[model samples]
Target: MKIGVALPQMAPGYGPGTTVDWARRIDAGPFSSVSVGERVTFSNPEMVATLGACAAVTERVQVLANLFVLPQHPVAMVAQQIGTLDQLSNGRLEVAVGVGGREHDYRSLGAEFKGRHQQLDDKVAELKALLAGEPPFEGADPVGPACVQPGGPIILAGALGPKAMRRAARWADGISGFSVRGDAEEIVKVGELADQCWAEAGRTTTPRKVNGCFTALGVPDASEALHSFVARYLGFLGPKLAEMIAASARASTPEVLAEILDGAEQAGCDEFILVPAVTDLKFVDVAAEVVAARS
Candidate 1:
């Protein structure tokens, strides 16, 4: 399994520079990739632009948008940006896209929130066509610099529901697991369903699966750390954040975290990205220990 670090783009008080520094630090360390999450109206900076800066500074680390909100942007424009980034990074770009669930974010962007699943599916198809060097629109110029790879950068669809998983199998190169809620049974079920969908689509090869989780290191108490972390970073979840905070608290210890990761690997996860719950770089230190042990 490959270990990656998620750059802190939405911490409580950190700025965009913090994300850059985190990317540089992770690249200098033993990580294979660095990821940034997307949030339009939230506190986080633009994912692709932040990652573009990271791509400029790093020579070896793979750059990823853990999941870009597909409903917020046009598919053609996203394809062009991703293709350019892939060329600029020498084929090191991997894009994970999903239909964002925040109603307020959609309202702010003036994008239709209903039927976003279908929109995401259509967008992914359009992106694939564009990356394959097809023209964005009928008489437009062909989108090129043509991705460093033959087709394009790896496209992973972030799917957390059954229908979305099937859509991922149909259109994306892989399915990103964002539904694991610290339950081993649920995690296994997610992997099983993903594999089933891929197979049902007549895909013989296993689709890549990526899992992500949040962590806070150097905290004396797991529950307190989890609560504080969610209260600050996941305020968008409303009151439900408290329940999620508690669930995450159960897996806070290093040993338990390792087991959780190992379970994911056993269930067919190809990569795991760890998001540090705290703003301090110390979580990276703890994550390094976890990676060393697991790898």
Candidate 2:
């Protein structure tokens, strides 16, 4: 299994300095990818800018927009930005598109929250066609600065449920799944569901299976740190729900993280990315240690 780390763009206290430094560290480590997730309504830096920073500095790892909220942005704009990032990464870009669960984010972006599922289903098709060099309309030129990857970056569905997986099989090369509790059984179940959904979609290729876990390591009171991070991140859901979700976070210490990695690989993850609660550079080194031991 390949290992990846997320730039702490969304964590509290994150800044451009941490973003650049973390990107360099991840690039220099035994890591396969550097990921940044999206959320426009929050304090996090914009996904494209953060990912652009990673791409500009990194040479060895794939740069991922791990969960680009598709419905919140114009499709044509997304195609252009992704195409540029794909080139910027020298063909080492992967995109995971999803209709994120946050309604407030969509509202704040001036994007309609309703019918987002349908919007996403339609936009994915449009994005693919645009990336494939199809003109937006007759007599109109195709978007320029074409992708470095011949067919464009590998598209992943940032999906978790049966309905989303079914929609994904038609367009996505894989699912960028996340386990809220770092559950191996959950990841295994997701792989099974992906297979079932793909076959039902009449797809010939097996979907690439990958999973991610939010972790809190290399910190004193790691468990509390993880809980605090999750609570803050998921605070939009209400204090009750946020606390419930935060308390359930599974991986906090190095030992717990090691087990989660083992379980994900055994659960058939082709790649596993870390979402860290803290931006301390020690997190990267410790993760490298754990991954190296497993490897």
Candidate 3:
């Protein structure tokens, strides 16, 4: 299985220099990809823009948008932006589009919270068509400067449940899954669901499977930082529930992290993106050493 890391863009105390430094280290490390996830009501930089910068600095690692909350932005604009990022990355881009669960983010952006499922279903098709150089359904001329990837970036669905996996069967190249609790069984179940969904859709090609988990290793106050970050990140879910989620993010030790990695690989994960909770660069070095030892 390939190993990847999340660009620490969403971690608290993140800044431009930290992000750039992270990108450079990831590029030089034994990592396969550098992924960025989006959250509108957060301390992170904008996903697409940060990815553009990452693409510029790193020539080897794949630049991935782990989840671009689709319904929050205009479809045409998203198409153009991703197409441009694809070009900027020289075909090294991978996109995982999803209707995120954050209602507050939608409200803040004036995007419709309800009916997002339908909007996402529609927009995925539109985005694909636009990337393929087809005239948009909106009767607008094709958006261009064309992607470096022939069919645009490999499109994946950021799926959290069966319904989302079903939707992925229709358009996505694969599923970008997250295991919030770092549970191997959960990741395996998700892979089974994706397989079942794809077969039900009569798809001959197996869906690509990628999973991510939050980690905080070899850092000062690692557990506290992990819990604090998770609580703040998922705070919208209510303090009690957020705490519950935070408590589950306990991969602060190399032993635990290795088990999670081994289990995920056994679970049929093709790639695992490790999301870091702390901003310390030492975490990267420690993570790389651990991963190298495993390799």
Q: If ranked by TM-score, best first, what sequence of candidates would result? A: 2, 3, 1
**Candidate 3, which ten residues in sequence have the lowest lDDT sum?**
136-145
lDDT of 1 by residue, 170-240 (tens): 87888666532445566677778888999999988888878767666645675466557666555667767
Per-residue lDDT of candidate 2, residues 132-191 (tens digit): 999888998988679999868999998889988888888899999999798999999999
Ranking 1 against 2 by TM-score, winner: 2
RMSD of 1: 2.1
The lDDT per prediction is 0.77, 0.90, 0.89
Better of 1 and 2 by lDDT: 2
For candidate 3, the TM-score is 0.97
* Backbone clash pairs in model 2 (N, Cα, C under 3 Å; residues 3+ apart or in different chains), count: 0
Q: Pick the candidate with the highest lDDT.
A: 2
> Which 10-residue window in model 2 sums to the lowest lDDT?
7-16
- List the pairs of residues colliding in candidate 2: none
